[model samples]
Target: MTDQLSQLKQLTTVVADTGDFASIAQYQPEDATTNPSLILKTIEQSQYQHLATEALQFAASTLANGTQAQRIALAADKLAVLIGHQLMQQVPGYVSTEVDARLSFNSMATIEKAHQLLDLYQQQGADTSRVLIKVAATWEGIQAARVLEQQGIRCNLTLIFSFAQARASAEASAFLISPFVGRILDWYKKQQPDADFSGAQDPGVQFVRKVYQYFKQHRYPTIVMGASFRNTEEIRQLAGCDRLTISPNLLAELADSHQPVIRQLHADVPFIEVPGALTEAEFRWQMLEDPMATDKLLEGIRQFAADQQKLEELLKAV
Candidate 1:
């Protein structure tokens, strides 16, 4: 009997949501993703210290007269790209490298940072096509993605929590959107502590299912890559999604399980109402109405930004 992980691969593309090279190698996922938190965690390990050292050295030599902040920022970017380039060696598909979460609402800044990341990748003799610049799915970030996509830079619009955000990302023609599943479940569980939120009744699972159906109904080309799963059940529920980025623990669970995995999502679902393009006001309003999404989006950005700051501080010390 094939493990659940292998069976999942038959229906959906499995992406490793980690920065650890060992985990990527162990799972043999087609693609990998990295964020401020993941990169910081991976770099703290002894085995990956050298990447940080190299990044610091590059920052020192390149920004000889730069301020401490500038040097730290460059080193952080270099570190992320170095990690991504290494990941590229392990996976045959794209490696997601996120821009500074602090620039989440700065469209031009996000685009500029993306170019810098790509340039660093190119300097390493990496194929830029194998890179996905991850941006928060803020309105500004979507605008940034629109510009980046026009320039042939594939983007992964992340921090998605609402349908408005997902639709806007697709309208921008982003290469992919990572709508978090486990995070949604977390919010609902907090609100309804005693609710029987198991199986198909899981809000996170239901949210992704709805988004997947909408995307397919509209024939949108943006890939809906479900991310941030908390358990294997959430993973199992979204089996046939366009792609799923799983953390090392969940990947291991799936790899160890022998239970039969069946496809739960499909592109042929009945079409839901397709509201025309969402205006900026309408988008903001939607987010405002959904307190869960608003809370999670803000919380996710703050967390990522905090991790980014921590990563920079580590680079400064090095």
Candidate 2:
């Protein structure tokens, strides 16, 4: 009998959500996703620091003619691109590299930073189609994605927690959206005393399911990629999602287990009302109305920013 992981792969594209390329190669996921936090964690203990050192040296040589601070920023961005380039060589599909989280709310800055990362890839002769510039799902970020999409720059709108965020991303015609599963489950569990949620009723599972149904009903081209699973059950619940970006730890568990797996989500279900585009004010108000979305989005950005800084500090120290 095939393990659950192999069976799940037959139903949906399995993306390894980590910066550790060795394990990524071990699983041979269709694609691989990386975030500020994962990159920081991986590079700290990974044998891949040589890649960062080489990128920093390249920045110092050809990337000269910038202020000291500007030089540091260039080095950091180069590190991210180099990492993405290496991972792209490993996976069959795209590798996601996130924009600076501090620019999460700034559309213009995010747009500029995004192309800058692509330019690095362009210079190295890496295929742009194998890259996804990850942006926070802020209204400004989604607007940034809209412009980038027009220029043929694909985007992965991430840190999503609510239907509003997902809807806005799809309206912007993003390449994909990563709705967090563990974080949503954490919020609801924190609120209730007994925390009885489980199976399909799990808040995180239900949230993604609702978004999946909404997209299927609308027939939107934007793909839904479930992310941040706290346990294997969440992964099992979302078996037939468009994609799932899973951690290496959970991937190892799925690789070992032969548990029964089945498609839990089907896009051909009864169609629901499709929501149209959201105005800037409407998007902000919707986030304000949903405390869980607001808190989780804020926390997610802060955590990413902090980890990026830590990665920067580590790079600088070397």
Candidate 3:
């Protein structure tokens, strides 16, 4: 068998889930994605400082002189587009640039920020199809995506854990939803250290599989992109998914190994509809009741928001 990376690509659309352009270019993933956390990771290195510098300069030049908060907001928007623009050069398909996680619960704010990010991408001479404005899978976020989709803006809903989030995203006509695998496993392992979650038995894998089946069964066009994977087994379990976005480290592992990775999840008969799409109350109640989903969702948002603040701090220092 050729390297697992190449073989897997035959069954699925492999996306590089990183902000590092060099690694993405080397792997040649079909698409590339970046969140506030990932973009902050890339900007930490001195070699990537120029991208930040460029964004700050762009912000200072284009944005009106405003309060410190306003300046930070402008700078963060620029940084997201700066990274996405660069990633677009490397990947042949779309580049996902996330909205500020701080606005995850604010539908109007999320829509506004998505436009700002998309505007920056367009200003860089890139088409709309080349970009995915990533938002959280909150009802507000999905609602924001619904409005954006009507206006021709595509969205990738992140931090999606439950099928409620998945169904709402699909109903919102989201372009994609990144169901986090590693983070799910992290939550399960912390809660149940004795449980065996290896391979197909993993909660994260099972969630993605069910969501994928639900989408394919119902003929929903929303794409399932399994993300935040922990190991090769998780990736292998989701081999035939619509897409799998792996980190550079995992991409390298797949590239180096010649494992004859076989497809696992397939479009079987779609299960019966779980229920109607979630209303805001239902969504909130479900999230509140599901401990793992609620905790991971909250944790992911806080971590991303923290990274956004750190990115702003970096802008201030430089």
Candidate 4:
């Protein structure tokens, strides 16, 4: 147990990136996170199918005297909160439940959805402090997070890729930030396979390091969570980050290995300094200039939005 716990601690803070309570219990990650996509995947598994039915039943009961649209919306919120509750039961740390991805671009709608998720969790006897509302790192989403954070609801800024998103999320004083390492590697691998990321020169490694450095340099309290890992190499490169939310498969891979994990990032090292605080215009310009970040951000949102719609259709069928 010491060896396992040491390995888990030496690397980034291990966060179980699944909706399955059993897996989370087995590993005992410090935290857990779920998105619409993860919830959708979990419901397809035979073992987890009960969660969906439970959600549907709860929604049905709540909406017994309400309209169809109201019932569906309430059902979605109930499902997310119930899943969050199950995860909290397995892990002692915080559990993240995302707002509907379709509301990512609408500040008011996103805020309303976030409140609905929180309300449902409270009704289930869960503490709001242990629940982080996950939202995409869109401009509007960041704004919504700003408002949510002010209202005392911690927010986890998800789908973050580039420095701009990280900067904006930190500026908003979000509770946590999940920057995708695997997706960034996927993009760069296709475009520059010959580029060496194994060394300190890896672009993906450099990107995350930069974000971590910025947060530390600015003394921002937002936690950096490296996510969406494709391979151990990316994870290895990001060792020493504040946190890393790894998939169950990757966690298994890390657990089975005995290779040495080194500390790659530290607070003492001086980070590259950027110009003074960026205005919204400057942030937008930088994101626009980086075509890759711009394209990937929009693409990620579109994919999540589509998956969200698909999940809604499934709920309606139920």
Query: What is the C-alpha local distance difference test score of candidate 4?
Result: 0.83
Which candidate should be chosen as best, given TM-score against the real structure? 1
Q: How close is candidate 3 to the true structure, as a TM-score?
A: 0.96
Q: Which lDDT tens digits does candidate 3 get at residues 51-113?
A: 878887777777666777687778788888888888888888988988889998899999988
On residues 212-264, what C-alpha lDDT tens digit does candidate 4 reach at each position?
A: 98888877889999888877767777778998888888877777777777778
Winner by lDDT = 1
Better of 2 and 3 by TM-score: 2
**Any idea what lDDT model 2 has?**
0.90
Scored against the true structure, residue 245 in model 3 reaches a CA lDDT of 96
Better of 3 and 4 by lDDT: 3
TM-score of each: 0.98, 0.97, 0.96, 0.93
Full-model lDDT for every candidate: 0.94, 0.90, 0.89, 0.83
RMSD values for the candidates in order, in angstroms, are: 1.1, 1.3, 1.5, 2.2
TM-score of 2: 0.97
lDDT per residue for candidate 2 within 1-318, as digits (tens), equals: 899999999988999999888899899999988888887877787587887788778778865876666666788888888888889889999899999999999999999999999999998789998899999999999999999999999999999998889999999999999999999999998899596888888899999998998889888889999999999999999999999999999999999999889999997876667665788888889999999999999999999999888877887888
Candidate 3 overall lDDT versus native? 0.89
Model 4 residue runs over 4 Å out of place are: 1-5, 65-67, 269-276
